[model samples]
Target: MKADYKNWMPKGMVTGTGCGTIASLVLFLILGVSPIVPEGSAKKVIGIVLLILTVIFCASTIWMYLMYRAFSYNGKRQMSKQIIEGVASYVSIPDGGKGLDVGCGSGALTIACAKKNPGASFTGIDRWGKEYASFSKKLCESNSEAEGVSNTSFMQGDACKLPFEDETFDAVTSNYVYHNIPSSDRQAILLETLRTLKKGGTFVIHDIMSKVKYGDMQAFVQKLKNMGYDDVKLIDTTSGMFMNKWESTWMGLSGSAILLGRK
Candidate 1:
């Protein structure tokens, strides 16, 4: 069976918008075509309003469809695969080394990194909350089994407070996760992910680290360097690495970037 890594754009948004669009169109036509409200009345104003709403919904549906296609596995853009492989490339481990994937929805990153380093073991953890009903621990496990990857495991856990001890894994990585967490101190969450990394280990965390969501990320990089991390750098993935500027802006992902280096 093909692994179903759900889209970044939630299904409800598109479906709800499409439904609103159709409903408004039907109401507008009924008000205008039927002689129920008579000419030049308040009903005409309501019909005009509904017509404008239909236009907005139509545009939203088209935009969402394009974005869904871009993020899909078989998409022309394939942004998800590119970003997963890109993050996995940084997860190099020696034979018998262990790795961790925080917020591993659908196990895409964990599976990709596991495939890249067959000799190492990988663990993926997520709360599998109701906000994302499609992603779960079982789904991650099944995807690994389907890919014939025996060295990976999945569990339910929190990103804010990882279940592992400090300096446990040889490598740690996450993609587009931390920002989604509802916390005023998002930097602390980043540090929590880093806390599980062994000294001299590597980390690659990608997310919408816009200044609004994460304040002064460059300063955070400097802080990591001052704290003795080596070669810590923040890279803008929207510069054609995973997506271009236009695509990022179009998809409401303007601040997408990858933070990588050794601890």
Candidate 2:
């Protein structure tokens, strides 16, 4: 499970653009050119370029947030805590059973689950290369060690194509990882998850469906039903905190939704 930097293109662009803007601004300030062009050469061009770049930089920041909000849970302060609990409540982790977590970012939910269900072994996969995978891996390992849990493991793998054999896990979970993908490719990921899940096993998906209309919940439910999940549930925690801001603007965004099902 490698962290895919490709998925975070906007975040990276935002950083680069911000740095460029700052550099340009510093250079302009040092030059101290008159507000009006000395001879009306091309000062307006500079002003226009700066303005356009500023707009792009701001928009990129917003796009990064929008991407995060699209799949992340609204409860920024409580997301990691509540998600761990919410997921734990759904599965009765059996002793010695194996579990899988797709895109196990910082390993928060994965480690928490291991702590909650010591009887089960957990393997969390994420490509980590996209953002500090080595650091995150160390933290996840340390978190597990601190809890005295040894049955946990991690690897780097793509969500679109998991590396495990078919029916490898008794339960599988993903959090806010799918919406980043293009809408066209989402079904491929879902079908891949289904292919890996053992019959009668449980699968949980916590992602954002903000792109779809509210009326589509039924269609969404029906789609899962057709996919062979006997039980499907959609939980909206938007009323909690940080959701609206995350969805609407850059600074306060932290959007996420939940969907759980049994395969």
Prediction 1 TM-score vs. true: 0.93
Question: For model 2, what is the error of residue 75's alpha carbon versus the real structure, in angstroms, after optimal superposition?
Answer: 12
Q: Write the per-residue lDDT of candidate 2 for residues 1-263, one digit (tens) a residue.
A: 43121222234555666676676665444333555345353665665676666566667666655554443434244334555667656665789888888877767667667777789998988877544423356666776776667888988788888898998888888876776665565655766876787777888776655644122554677787887788877766455532454432443323345666777
Report residue 88 deviation for candidate 1 (angstroms).
0.5
**Model 1, 99-176: lDDT tens per residue?**
999999999999999999999999999998887888988889889988889999999999999999999999999999
Worst 10 residues of 2 by lDDT: 1-10
List residue ranges in candidate 1 displaced over 4 A: 38-41
Per-candidate total of colliding backbone pairs? 0, 17
Error (Å) of candidate 2 at residue 92 is 2.5
* The candidate that achieves the highest TM-score relative to the unseen native structure: 1
C-alpha lDDT values of all predictions = 0.91, 0.64
